[model samples]
Target: MDPATLIGIALAFIIVVVVNVMEGGNPMAMILIPPMLLVFGGTLVICLAGGTMGDAKLAMQGMVKAFTSPAPSAAQLVPELVTLADKARREGLLALEDYVADLDDPFLVKALTMAIDGTDPEELRDILEAEVHAKKAETKQAAKFWTAAGGYAPTIGIVGTVMGLIHVLEQLAQPEKLGHLIAGAFVATLWGVLSANALFLPLGARITRLGELEVAQMELVIEGVGALQAGSNPRLVAQRLRSLLPASQREEEAA
Candidate 1:
């Protein structure tokens, strides 16, 4: 699981609760049903209307995958690619076929399968590049579902705030209860803003980040498969693949 995602969410909630308590504010005062239903329900209504049901499902699945699935370890893939490069250079592209069934990553399997089938180097690049772009586009659409919700949330909160103000004005003759009514009305605004920033906005940002990581890993596959097809030396292939990583992660490959 993604510790950072979990920790960030937990910390946000903890800080808010602690501060509320420390300030002598009633933590329960924030729990109003109407404002919450308006912000959350309204956001979902617009998001679903804007995108397909499949897109909404994918977005939820994407969020779960982001938190639960570990990214492919490129450090491990480097060695595997080096081994493939050496075997291909020694025994030809067809020799790599022996390892294809054993490969776990479907992307790698497809790219290497094409290479073994004697696909032209440029054609191989085009095929893999197209797949990469298609996958990236799909993932991006999933993220847009959440981002659209995030964009709508704050504005929806303002609508709730206005509704609350209207309720307050309707009972304006009761001067003694005006302060309480005003505070209750503002609670809708709080729910909207907090839910947007704390939940939807952050969820969208994390989905985008996870998409970038996934695309980078797939690009590495393209490079690895290309190098194997080109008959580059094993060590040189390893070096080239290692260059795709950030400087900090590159050090782990060295070790």
Candidate 2:
């Protein structure tokens, strides 16, 4: 599980609840069913109308990924690529074939398989780059769905607030109920802004960041495979892959 994503959401809710308690406000004031339906249900409508049903489904999946998907690290990959390069250089391209079946990452396996099969380097690069681009595009579109939801939620909440006020106005003659009615009406606005900032927006950003990290890892794999296929020195392959890591991480790894 992603601790950052989990802790961020938990912290947001905890802060709101604690502040409400300190202010002598009802702890349950934020839980009105009508406002929730208006904000969340209306967000669904907006999301569906803006994109295809497939995109909506992918966006939901992306949210789950944002919280649970473990990102691939270049640091871990560098050693694997270096070892493959050494084996290929010591024996031959055919020697790498045996190791392919033992690999867990399908992407790396496919790249190595193509190299062993005598695929042209240019053709290989094209295929891998296209696949990477398409995958990133799909992930990006999924993130955009959440971004649209965040943008629409606040407006939908305001709409609900207006609707509630219209109902409150009808009870104007009953002055004793006016204050309670107005406070209840504002709950819709609260639901909209809170959900937008705390949930939808953060989820979108997380998905996007995850997508970028995935693409970066794939790109590193492509370069590593290219080096191995070219029969480059193992240290050269390791150096090229290490460039993908941050300066601080590079230093630590070297140490």
Candidate 3:
């Protein structure tokens, strides 16, 4: 995890615990079974009911993958692609045919191979860009599921709070303790809101942004190689590819 994300999570938990201690209650109260069940169960029901089962399942898998495993960074890819571009320029585009096996990423290899096939520059751009958009849409579909789940979680939390309130109200003998019950019950809503904003929503956005950034870099490689294949000056091709970077990343050697 990024340091920023890690710090944010740590601070949120710290703040919650501090507040709970200030309330003269156990700091770990939220970890209690009733509150957890209310939050997760309610969110699950809302997601499963409001979204396709496939989307819900996909969203769960996405969240798991985001926490457990992250894909390689865009900067990590720059060297690999630069080598591919130099090789293509040196041996002719056709010569890249043999190196495709060394390339592991299906998307990158496909884009490079298409450029090597002497695909028209405009057509190559269109085809690769189209496929990128298609894959992006699919990837965003995974994020959208979490976004939709995030949207639904709060409402279900409110539902759970009301249910808790109803249950508490029915206990006539324990009326004096209703305040603590209600307070604890509302923790469900707190969990829902926090999970939505801090967890699912940000994670979904991060994955979407990362996917788009990587795709943009891949598109740059495709365009650069296309120009190289057409015998564009190396300086001109470098200039064109450099345009793909922001002013900051342009400082890289490839720029």
Candidate 4:
């Protein structure tokens, strides 16, 4: 799990709930149950019913990918790529075929296999870059789906509020139910705002970033492996890969 994302959300929600409860709002008013059902559950059912199961599943898969994947640190790939490059140089390119079988990353394996087999460098780059682009497109599709949901939610919330107001107006003959009806109506708006900022937007950005990082690392494998095949020195591979790293990370190691 991403410690920052998970912990920040938990701490913020706890603070919000505690503060609002102390402010004398109904304790159950802070309850996430009914609003969550209306916002998330209802939206999910509506989306699935509309035949966007693939999009919905991709959204959930994004969360799973983020949670399960421990991203390679910025400079982490350097040492590994250097070692692989050295091995490629010492042993003939055909030696990489043996290592390829041991590789777990499909992208890296595919890239190295192409390089070792003496495929044209441009063709290899094209094939790998195309895969990277396609993965990015898939990531964007998933992020866009959730972002679209975020956009729809506030309007849906407003619609829900209007529906609630309609119910409240029906009770205008009885002054007793007026306050409760109004409170329930406003819950819809609250659900909309909270869900947008707290959930959808953050999730979309997180997943998109994860996809980008994965693709970048794969591209590194592509570049470094290509260099290795072309007889570039391992030190040069390390230097080239370092250029792709974040400045902060580069600074940390420089220290």
Candidate 5:
């Protein structure tokens, strides 16, 4: 599993605690249960109200994916596509069928299988591109759920803070306890802002980024499959696919 999300979130909380200690504040004081429930629980219900149950499921799945799934690598697929191109060029498109059973990527396998089945180049492109678009839409919806939660969290936090302040105001007769009550009241706002910036927003952004990477890899596969169907040269297919990758990844391939 990719540790980026885990590490980043852990570090963010650690930094917050460290800063609180540096300011001569009790870190444990910020861990109030009422505010935690209000901000986190309130944000969750509001987000659910804004979207359907399907979106919630997708969001949860996306969250798991963000924390666990490694980024897709289009650069790594280049060599494989080039090999397929070379094989098809030498033994013809029919030869690619032999390689299909051993291939791991379902996208590549599907594309090559269609090509081997004598699917028209234009029809194949249309079908593959349509699948890519559908995937993009799914990921977009999943990311939207988190983005909405991030947007709602701070506002929910403010509401919690206001409620806390209302309680603080009721204890006005106890002047000696005013400072402690005031501090405790603001914990709602703190958790709200903290969860949004450190957790929710980052997860939303990560899901979007991961989706883009996966889409890029799919697009690369489409192009590679198209080239193979058209009887393109292996070197040219390699060059075309490489051009679609980032400079950093291209450099890695060269190395």
Candidate 6:
């Protein structure tokens, strides 16, 4: 599992608590149960209401993926593609069938299998590209769910704050308790804004970024597979695939 998201979220909350204490506020005061439920629970149901059940399922999966999915490494695949290109060049595309089970990436395996089975290069490209497009659409929907939640969270928080303020107003006769009650009322607003910036929005962006990375990796595989099917030189295949990577990764590969 990727630790960056976990570490980042934990650090954000820690810093918030630390800063609250540094400002002479009791961190526990911000932990009001009513506001917590209103802000978080309300936001959740509202987001769910906005989307279908399938979208909700995708969003939950995306949330897990954001915290756990490893970043794709297209750089690593280049050498493997180059190796396949070399074998196909030396022994023909049929020779690659012997190596299919040894390949780890299902995407690469599928591409290589198709190539070895005498799939026309154009048809293979079309099929793989279609699959990539479908994946992009699915991931896009998942990320959209989180992005919608992030947008709704702050508004829900404000609603919670307003409700709390209504309750505070009812106790106006008790001037002695006004200050504490007012502070508690504002906790809804704090949680709303804090959760939006620190949690919901970040998760949405992370999911979007991960989707993009996966798509990029798949695109690289498509190019690699195309080169292999064409029986391109291993050196040319490596150069072509490396060109598709970031300059930093290309430099690392060269080293």
Best by lDDT: 5
Give the per-residue lDDT of model 1 (tens digit) for 82-132: 898899999998887879999988888999988888889999899889988
Model 6: weakest 10-residue lDDT segment is: 246-255
Off by over 4 Å in 4: 30-35, 45-51, 251-255
Against the true structure, candidate 3 reaches a TM-score of 0.82
Question: What residue pairs clash in candidate 4, if any at all?
Answer: none
Q: What is the C-alpha RMSD of each candidate to the true structure, in Å?
A: 1.9, 1.4, 3.0, 2.4, 1.2, 1.2
Worst 10 residues of 2 by lDDT: 69-78
CA error at residue 34 for candidate 4, angstroms = 5.5
lDDT for model 5, please. Answer: 0.92
Candidate 3 lDDT trough over 10 residues, lowest sum:
68-77
Give all TM-scores, in the order shown. Answer: 0.91, 0.96, 0.82, 0.89, 0.96, 0.96
Residue 231 in model 1: lDDT? 85
Return model 6's CA RMSD, one decimal: 1.2
lDDT sort, best first: 5, 2, 6, 1, 4, 3
Distance (Å) between predicted and true CA of 145, model 2?
A: 0.5
Candidate 2 displacement at residue 2 in angstroms: 2.4
lDDT of 2 by residue, 1-255 (tens): 657887898799889989999999997977899989999999988899998999999998998898888765556677888999999999998998889999887888999999999999999999999999998998899999999889999999999999989989999999999998898899999989999999999999999988887787789889999998889999998888888887865775676
- What is the model-wide C-alpha lDDT for candidate 2? 0.89
Model 3, range 40-63, lDDT digits (tens) per residue? 676767767776877777777766
Worst-scoring 10-residue span by lDDT in model 4: 27-36
lDDT (CA) per prediction: 0.83, 0.89, 0.70, 0.75, 0.92, 0.89
Model 5 Cα lDDT, one tens digit per residue, 1-255: 778888999899999999999999999999999999999998988889988999899999999999989988888899899999999999999887778999988998998999899999999999999999999999999999888888988899899889988988999999998899899989989998999999999999999999999999999999999999889989999999999999998997777
